[model samples]
Target: MSIAIKGGNIFQNSRPFFDEKMKFPSLEELTIINLRGIAELWHLANVEDEFPAFPNSENPGDSDALFNNKVALPAIKHIKMSLVDGLQKIWGSHLDVRSFNELESLDIKFVEKATKAFSLDAIQRIRNLKELNLQQFQLTGQFIERVGFYNDEVENSVLLPQLRNLKLDSFPQLKRIPWRELTLQNLRCLQISEIHDLTYLFPASICKRLVNLEALRVYDCHKMKEIVREELGDANTVEVKVVFPHLNFLRLSNLPAFQSLGSDNVILEFPSIKEVDFDKFQNPILWDLLQKLKPVKELQLGRCESLFELHDLKGRSSTMLPRLRNLTLSYMDNLQRIPWMIFPIKNLRYLKISYIHGLKFLFTASMCSEGFAQLEEIHIQDCKDIEQMLAQESIEDTSNNAAPITVVLPRVKIIKLYYLRSLRSFSSENYEALEFPSLEEVEIKEYDKEYFDLNTVIKKRCTTRLCYAR
Candidate 1:
């Protein structure tokens, strides 16, 4: 049975909301919200033998047993406690974790002193714990050894062998976790954010332990320079490759000190990864790493200041983005051009570019020489120097001027242009025209929201939808 206490002065000094003669029996799920009392009413379920439910203050026979009684929740599996501020201790004196044999999931947020609430001994008692999330606790010190601190099991046995998911955020004192030294055979998902001191996510000992890990997210770790650290001191500078065989999603953002996954000597591979998003200053090592991974369906790269222009696809033999579908580029101050023609890819459907000050054009004339996207939407915003969509390069050689080709975006339905201060036309003087066949809507937000004939620019500069598109 599941019971949720919505609103009340539920527990005032262990005088639970339940009146006299009421018993909490066969309870499985419990939720308490905004109850300002140190007594967690669920503790009553722990005491095997029935105790006086609550002191009947009006009756002389009722005795106050608040401090003397200790309770254990053996049947409760899932627990969510929110806004119960008066809780002096969570797994403290009143609650006994040894009886929490069936506890599976615990989520505690926006509470104070939650770090000291549950003693390390209490956490080690639950053998079946699966998920633990601690947020906004501002915790310090070795919060829990089971969360990958001590390596030696004889000293501190791996508490939750069944634990699969763990999230720790906003811990400033946490410099590093001893995950590599411990054995977490089943732990798969790990997310650490706002931890400033962590220089690297995994050391040499822990990288290989994540055999079941699928997703890794590290955010706002300003001092974090690498996702994984490579071990050294071997032969003539040998490199080690760490492969996350089942990892599918990886997101790294707001990490100012963040650089590459590892040094050029160490290689990182994600064979099953499908999506990757990175917002960091440009590190050539990162670009070099992407060439070796499985083709991603969604790729976003932003806030990279060192990337002046992407010149890798100039004559690369193998196409890197063979399975790309959605691409976004933002906050790239030094980026000048995207060599769209550099790769032989056609799966792209949506494209967005914003906050690029040095970009003079979106694509080069070389890009139009090849194929175009089966695009549905194109959004270009806040670009200070985007004078043209497709840049034109004047070629003097007659052999290069064999024909004037038209590139068509057949299914373009929505086109949005905003704050493009130096807007010109879509195409340059070299191409015949760039065409959008199925254009339905065009929203242009400029200094003056005046009616501008965007269709006229398309008709004169860009090619209309080709016969196949029509």
Candidate 2:
């Protein structure tokens, strides 16, 4: 039920890979890789006599009439093709629809010369397709329109009605995606990357149609200005509320022109989102969006040059990020320190910081005395100005009774420090050693031993494995 062909020039003379006389009743999966000089895949010798269901009709009715009884590969479910440079067409114009009616998944990658994957008529017949991935193709707007509906007025007409997952990547010439013309209610995952000419993603009319979308990731789009474009209708038009009820994972990275999701006329909501990643983003609007993401558990921010601090956290209540367990900050040269007062430290388990040039220390001595009860891992690397892990400070008291307190890290198990040239000690000179009841392993690389001693940082009775490199 499976056929695989790789690295061959067998069908080079404008011939079909599957001849008209061939009939495959039980073939289910087909994979072709690194094939050269292949012009076409399927062939039908007689177009009028063999398949006569939709001869003169513009709109085909009754899905059963599209399939021919004698069609080859009648039960095929999956097809994948990669690195087929010379392939011009997937199938002939008059090929029988039964060969692809049962197909569920189709993936094509690195087929640069092929302008389109399937003929307009052939794509509409594959009603059972659930997943489609096209990468490194030279397709344009015409290819997208060909796969979509030919006539919008056709009653109850939709293209790829059963498709659930769709990915389009590295299409440089593609400038627009006609979301309003396509019906994609069943789509769950949509990812688009490296489409340089695209200026915006979704128009206002297409938001309600993507009700089932769970994951949306757009990366490396240099010109994208908004995820959803604001449309101004007549004065009678009511306010628009854009909501993704089931979406949980969202990542937008390396988008320089992106400013906001939508304008003032639109209300944005992501009720089920749990994870968010933002990198190389420079906009104050991002802070407004983060204030609404109270349910996000894992957050990663990197290379945001304009960010000097968490400006929104300065005056807000401590209830922000109540569920956050993992946090990563990297390549932020202007950031001075972590705003510990805004973080819900009891729920934080993992903390990673790297390439932060301006930060001097991670926590204050008073902060360490409170203990990170649930913190499990600490990783710090490539920080040029960091002098210590904790800064020496006395606990604030109103009646002039301030006192130095003992540092307690009750649950921390692993500590990793690398390439921190300015780091002198774990804490300032006041605390000779810190309590590490659950410490198991410590790793230090490229650190100066003359400035700080390992014996002065940890208690001698604590049995901990230490790994040190030059």
Candidate 3:
């Protein structure tokens, strides 16, 4: 059920745990938590077979001998092997997960076998596996493509059918997501993050085959150039449709190669999509298509240096999000103003506007309250030129009684004007009138304390927890 591998001398002590010939227990249930990193010198005893004729001074003994010792893990519901030295090959003839017929979950990481493959045969062994996580392992060119010496023959391995949830991080060598090798018809949530060299993920033709896929997230992969590069004359028209049709939530970050979602060729689809996060990246037609998201409930746009207008959120905009509940705009170095006079949707409950240095006026008119009065929360931070939270004359009902405007976030709860040498004060007049009757906590980092003492600014009735990291 659980396993831990630690300490510096595990290799030396592993000999005594077993008999004269290593042997393991055969029990109805077994747990092997290794803490054997205690050895003074780390030696690969397993390498002896390959370099057997070496001088007598260097031999550590047979690597497989340590593991070959009979250790019975009968009816083992869990099997964890840490600091397993003989793993110069992951799918060796002696290694198998299927042998643990009762195994339900598997977590394997830091396997030193750099060139070893976790073969389809190895994965097929875990027929009952419900959850599998492989983190920080040195996988070879067997599963993914474009590794230094990859061969297509090894890339065509079969998929893992029983695996439902998968998280991949920090596999820099993997260039392509092995789409055809793995069957993910049952997968519900997929998170692929920090895979630096991964370029193309989804297959052009098999998007619809992943029928059960609900959430697809790709983040922090720097070298990834494109998702489906049809505009480059590469992708087929039909493939993009089948893949993203059923997706409900999608997040793309730092993917510079991903230029557009759909062509004018057809309505940029993703009909079932409910939320999208485009964080800190620039793309071609990204704003043009983002403007077309009609049914999206939450849209977050941040750090797009090329974005200057809401041309995407304009026009009769049949695509304007009518149901959007939360809209977050932050760190858009190029954004100058809010594009539309009609603030967010009447149903919009939370509006977070932060760190857009280029913004001078959020809206053209002051006291522009027609579409914003229904909003429960409005947060504006770090846009020095925007002097007021809400335009002074925008709402006739400043009376706190009308329909609980922006009730969710009535005031700025956390304000960090860190290193903002120009900021003289949070507000110049009637700062006390700023409403956040329910505000409870605040965190300020790297800010000058000479201008205002936080203890004096907080409301008497509300409990505020302030974390100041100066």
Candidate 4:
């Protein structure tokens, strides 16, 4: 049977919702769109053996509600509640998953009431659950600290064995999620948003246990300080590397207090990640940890006010970002320069740098011929101090008195330059010829002074797109 209560006054009496002769043995899906009394559903699903276990069930007259409760819904699978304002909670502890044998998905929203103490123990027995989502359920404290919240009583237990996806959003009072305590073997994706009090997202134990998690996203968590908490170690023990084994997509945004994700005490590894995004600020360790990541394809660091430069990628190191294709550096006010050799991405396809005021140059002429072999596109905008694309002293032969230099970017096809007040030439010397045989389109807009001649450098087949302030 399927039930969807659109908008109607709930029956006020304590009679059965369905006729006894209707034979509605189990439900496949149930949706509650708005407020309606649902105490009867709980009363019907409750069992006398379950009620007797709760001391509060012995109340003076409340037991009368369940005296004839033998409605069996042993096969209910999907349930979603959009706004059940009249129904405080479905089942606190009076009902457990002992009745929801085939339940697979549960989603609830706007569970707000002033007097009820809701416990989530009702869902633990649902061993077949694959997805669980709770939104705007302003729970302030723990109801069952161990089984539902921390440890389950089921011995040799792998809690929520089939659960694959979990999401928790808008719980302002939640300080932590018991990822370390949950022995879930199949959880694959997790998203937590608008939880203002969580100080850290992962414990060291979770990094060791959650080998199947693929994507993790956390946003609008105002008080979060770190993505992973370093496990406290014994004074004299060895710390092995902790790997997220399968995590491929990671996004951390709008977290002002974020610091190191791993501890100074343990080595961390992400061998399978393909893309990483930081929408706002980040800590120094995030940049430091990138050294250990596997080959990533796309990376974007946007509006990161705390980041000054790509300082860690410099110097001689065995680190390689071999699979990087698209790289964007945006709104970073303090980034100083881009040294192409610092990046080992020889086949890099696209690069963009925008609104970075402190940036001065993209590369030195001497390194340009040795780097960016298979590049296709380049874009630079709103960088006021960028005087040249390549540094001239990098290739000028001072010992030979003077000589003409030709800089080659063989596979370059598209380039855009905008709002650069200080650019004088592609190279420091105004006479050097910059060659782009495969150039297709070029855009130069709103520069305070004309620096490079489009006709002289690009082939006649290339088209220049232009827009000037005047």
Best by lDDT: 2
The residue-by-residue lDDT of candidate 1 on 284-360, one tens digit each, is 64566467654677777888675544465456625776777778888987777765653444667788899998898
What is candidate 3's lDDT per residue for 152-255, written digit by digit as tens?
A: 64355444666677777656666666666677777777878778776666544556567777787888877665454333343444433434567788788776
TM-score winner between candidates 2 and 4 = 2
lDDT of 2: 0.72
Model 4: per-residue Cα lDDT at residue 304:
73
lDDT of each: 0.64, 0.72, 0.52, 0.66
Using TM-score as the measure, name the better of candidate 2 and candidate 3.
2
Residue 80 CA displacement from its true place in model 1, Å: 3.3
What TM-score does candidate 1 reach?
0.71
The alpha-carbon lDDT assigned to residue 321 of candidate 3 equals: 72
Evaluate model 1: give its lDDT.
0.64
Which is superior by lDDT, 1 or 3?
A: 1
Candidates 1 and 2 compared: the better one by lDDT is 2
* Per-model tally of clashing residue pairs: 7, 0, 30, 1
1 or 4: which has the higher lDDT? 4
lDDT per residue for candidate 4 within 49-149, as digits (tens), equals: 43232122212122222112344566679978776544544445545333667879889887664123234455456678899898887765552334345
Could you list the CA RMSD of all candidates, in the order they appear?
7.1, 6.5, 7.8, 6.5
TM-score of each: 0.71, 0.80, 0.67, 0.71
